[model samples]
Target: MTVRTLFDRCRAFQARMPLAGFFSHSTAAVLHGLSLPKALEGDSRVHVSVVAPTRAPRGEGVVGHRVDARPSVVLVADLQVANPVAAWCQTTA
Candidate 1:
């Protein structure tokens, strides 16, 4: 999917989750202005993180994680996402 399509779809999905959702992993990396390897730039799923003790969201083109997200998630183009450090750490796991 196009970058715009991915971003738009993510934002739409985020709106439906509790308190919106925090983008994580590669998705957060992009929001934080980090460059991903060329091969991974076009991943289909939009990575998002939700609170622990909850099931990861499931659907087409979305990958979810359970984590202790910070209260200071940044907003990029109206998409809520984890901070750079948290995002980078998530990607490492």
Candidate 2:
């Protein structure tokens, strides 16, 4: 999908979920400003991790992060973008 289109989709999906923060993994290398060090990037899923105490309400785009893994890091919803995985790919490549 186009970058703008995908970002819109992710933003809508994130709006529905009840999460504190969401982060990107391999797909978000560039979005997180790690474009030069892409050698460490891995995984296939557009993995978007969240830092919410309760399970985030499901919608689409993201698979939703579980609370069991994260022990800390919970910032408020002040994000500017979503579906950062795709954004990273666009930036890196």
lDDT of 1 by residue, 38-71 (tens): 6677776788778876667777777878776454
For candidate 1, list the clashing residue pairs, or say none.
none
What's the CA error at residue 84 for candidate 1, in Å? 1.7
Instruction: Output the number of the TM-score-best candidate.
Output: 1
Could you give me the TM-score of model 2 versus the true structure? Answer: 0.41
Scored by Cα lDDT, where does model 1 land?
0.74
TM values, all candidates: 0.77, 0.41
RMSD of 1: 2.4
Assess each prediction's global lDDT (C-alpha) against the native.
Answer: 0.74, 0.44
**Deviation in angstroms for 21 in model 1?**
2.6
The lDDT, on a scale of 0 to 1, for candidate 2 is: 0.44
By lDDT, the best candidate is: 1
